[model samples]
Target chain A: MDEAAIHGILSRLLMAGTLPGSVKLGEHRLAEIFGVSRERIRKVLHRLGHERLLEIVKNRGAFTIEPDLREGRVVYEARRILESGMAAHLADNLTEAQIARLRQHVDAEADALRSGDQPTWLRLSAEFHFLLAEMTENPIVQRQAHELISRTLMLVKRYETTAGSACGCEEHRAIFRALAARERGKAVKAMHSHLSLVETRLRPTICVEEGPSLEEVIAHEIAVYREANGAALMAAG
Target chain B: MDEAAIHGILSRLLMAGTLPGSVKLGEHRLAEIFGVSRERIRKVLHRLGHERLLEIVKNRGAFTIEPDLREGRVVYEARRILESGMAAHLADNLTEAQIARLRQHVDAEADALRSGDQPTWLRLSAEFHFLLAEMTENPIVQRQAHELISRTLMLVKRYETTAGSACGCEEHRAIFRALAARERGKAVKAMHSHLSLVETRLRPTICVEEGPSLEEVIAHEIAVYREANGAALMAAG
Candidate 1:
């Protein structure tokens, strides 16, 4: 329905970073973009608002979400658990077809990177694990993997990529190698390390400009860094 | 809010086998139970349909999910990947507090078992590891634990208590001991083995009688499970 269409456009916008943070987003703009009705856009906006992906201001319009520190950690916490589980399953019964699909995906990512299409590369790189989860032939795992991927996406967008080289083809290469060897333990370890390395590559910091504090949203992400870097960050803000 | 309430009741019915597959759940009956209207019940039904926890027939009604052979394997495949990652994280930071919490969860399950509260015991046993995921101090791990827990709940409900005791409390206690002893490597191994054991406990041969297959209602228990099981059982189911 209209909701699905809205999801398509909003997801694309999210990926493109066209609508980030607390910018006002009118339904009319979305309607015009997709040649849809304002009513349809509103429906999708409401759905996204409920999921915390969009902030809907009363009498205003939808805006992007920005999680505080703690919430950011929640994003990573979810990714770590889900991704590692996915890696282990991939260890169990990896098929040549699945490997081929993954290879194709990585190849596409490399091509994207070479073309300097960072967005496509970023999406493909992030989706590689989900593609792996799908191959595992487990809906439960796939579902969990799906949720983690969404959360991770949000977290990555929030921090914006300070380290810059977020795409590590070698990391994917190492993961596939372990899988090829049928070394389940090693693969799981590599996956865990890969996620950590990927996360670390994004400097665990955000510059909050002069504005109303977003303490609640960021609490989950910042809980760990508080009493250490929190004070300075707040002072600077 | 009503949607959350409906999922709570639906999950209960499924896990308790009160509403087995093939049974027709009339909207009136469910609405009566929830003290809501038929219109609201219908909405809830559709939402559960989204989670794959319930299946809504064109003319019949919603029923608990029953995965076919192919879908069943997909569930396990998904869990393997998700849990493996969790196992790695657990291995990396198998702290004393976390170990204590896990042991405490196990001990409570033992007490529940001794008290002959089979349902409570079964639910708690699953929650033990899920709670363990939280102690990894990672939200990603926690969220994955939650999704995997839901699938596990569905799997256990269908296949569990068919032959074996409610849960392998002994296995949980044993794993707790390994974890408490600061044997990170062994603990991770034990966790993988524990998940494997649980997977084995599933009906090696699934026969979908008359319920909605799990993929139909994935996050059906967001309210009750979280409220009842707290963090632990929430993760397990």
Candidate 2:
């Protein structure tokens, strides 16, 4: 599989709580299931490690990193800085279509929330912020914002249990309205407040002592991967 | 050798112009010289690739990235944001000893400039900004700032010649004075202006279409690495 495909699958698993924090990734098993060499798996693992999702140890291999309280705060702090900067840029740069897309995303987020689908809701909420960053058209800021968002996902998965309104749909709508109205000050303010609400909702401390059956999780993902890409699987070999 | 040690050596060489951009790394030669396995060398290369210093190819090998004008601007933009944040924090939190260290570093920069040593001068100038970021004690910001600063070093080496005072020693002193006075506003302004000057001084379209003998350069570094670590080299294996 290509690195981006692997990255997507791994990221989804991470967000879905299938690969919980503190889980040790068995590279050999992953390689076997993915029908790829251990080297390709290692490359993917290295990329995730660089993203702070996995911690690579010498000889011991890679493990999903457990986000602690300090990291949780740091991630939010970075988000505030980057997102605030992004909101300002978006105020100046976002096109009507971009604003419309953001509104559509918020409607989807509301649907997910109303359906009580916590995972989709959470992902969409994160995506809303990421979309704002993406609209800024600054790759460097986008990359850093993505890193912060992904790491925050680890914390969210660990701490969040049920549907929460920390990143409420209404707040997202308010931020979008401000952006649509081209109110730069209001947009920045709304973004900062939204992030603050999100940060506040995170538990004071959230850590999983251990995860169950990381191997089984990998096996399940392999089945899903095969079903998703029957043709690509044959093409690779 | 450990990844950190390898990283240090490669960073020094890159900054000193010993390993120019566009130079392909010889993993086998590096493994042989370091008395480490190819796998270990690959690990280090992967780390550097993640840092954007090395561009790794699948069937091919890793090569130092040739920073373009666009990348040059992006690096400076990232620096301006991160460094300004850092200067604001440092102005409030810098200890008396930290101020002394800043003065001492600028003295070194001035000394390097006086000696007409462009490499040392360039590295020290970058180090000054890094030191400022380090004082913030925020690892996330520090890591991002360091990445930008190091990448800027690559651009400086490729584009700079004859020590044109992009990062003038007086500007470093001005920043230090602001920090020493605990003037947060002035410190941030000084940092922004300093960065602006540095960015302005870079050639508009700096690109190295070609470089000299990369193999000989790698060979020379191996000799230098061995001489510098004769004791540690024996201890490792």
Candidate 3:
């Protein structure tokens, strides 16, 4: 029932697009689903509201935020600044263990992409940058980078039409190669171009005229997500 | 009763050194002072604990964090990286209005220093860097800079011994002069040296053999802080 646990669950649901933009959050159902009290759910909702992931109405309830073009650009710009710094640091301080760990993540991303698992591919792609951040050995910068990456992921989930196309496997490999070679300028350049490519690939989805009910939206999104990933929808439950 | 308001109040008290290191927070007293319920105060205290400003125990109440040298160094390092980035960006994007604002803040810092107002001097010194961040027009960088500066302030309060020596007026003037002249290299060098000087000046206090009671400790700290700045204790009340 801690706020962090609830936040992780809610964030996962948001990433899976189970709670589409403007869909109402059913507090009672969420409390039941999480096996926590209504008050605990309220706290999670309030915290998410502060994070700009949800918009809370006075009489009604919280709804998922509809990502806009401005927010998308801002998040991507932040990612570029933070990750470019990480890449530069990693190039200067690249270690065998860190390089091995990053290669492992890149392998996993390739596997997910090969299997056409969009959700897993997206998760691994994001994890690659986080792993780069951890290699820098600065917890403060690592934390800021993680927050910006998560926000950018949320924006991507809202706008992305084709998941596998957003992150090119070769760009990650190019950046890793540059870091392994201790080319600081090349690593920074690769990171910037990689992020720019990801931003370019994100095209906003078409909006539907009629907004569906909360349960219907969640179920439909879950179905589509499961169908795309070939995984059971056990995360939300 | 919101977290933002409570955080602001606690942050100010921490900055003013009215709540010294390891002083146990009186939840009941704060609830009465803020005119809120105990639960609301607990939430704020819990959040502060997460922020490393307070240490919460299962049986014992939360106590203000006794910052260590490691944290002090880490905070200053983060600030240098962030503010140096801000200075470089501002050099490229400096406007007449921005220059005027920067000069105005520098003037305030000089006035505070001349008047021997420790609290105002500390506040303005911190605001000078924050103003530079705002001039970048990048909200994400601005937010990260604010957090790092605030955390650095917390560390400074815990370790700083000299009243008016931590931030020198001439250093601020030098940074302004460099920025006004549009010398990017000089600006970054000035900012980095200013932060380095501040870090070098922070000397930790010696630990006493006997510990004071919670109320006595808070009262004594408050008295010392107020006498140092010629301010009433109205901020807490």
Highest DockQ against the true fold, candidate: 1
| Candidate 1 lDDT over residue span A165-205, tens digit each | 54576788788888877787788677767877766665556
Computed on alpha carbons, the lDDT of every model, listed in order, comes to 0.65, 0.75, 0.73
Query: Which consecutive 10 residues in model 3 chain B have the weakest lDDT in total?
Result: B228-237
Docking class of 3: acceptable
Off by over 4 Å in 1: A24-43, A46-52, A55-63, A67-70, A104-120, A154-158, A204-237, B1-7, B26-29, B56-61, B67-70, B112-120, B137-144, B203-237
Candidate 2 stretches with Cα past 4 Å from truth are A1-4, A35-39, A85-100, A103-118, A161-167, A170-193, A204-212, A223-237, B1-4, B15-21, B29-37, B85-120, B161-193, B204-212, B219-237
Residue pairs that clash (backbone atoms under 3 angstroms), model 2: none
> Which of candidates 1 and 2 is the stronger one according to lDDT?
2
Q: Write the per-residue lDDT of candidate 2 for residues A150-230, one digit (tens) a residue.
A: 788777767754446534789999899999998876886788788778777777544445555766776677578768788
Query: How does the DockQ of candidate 2 come out?
Result: 0.27
Point out the worst 10-residue segment of candidate 1 chain A by lDDT: A212-221
TM-score of predicted structure 3: 0.77
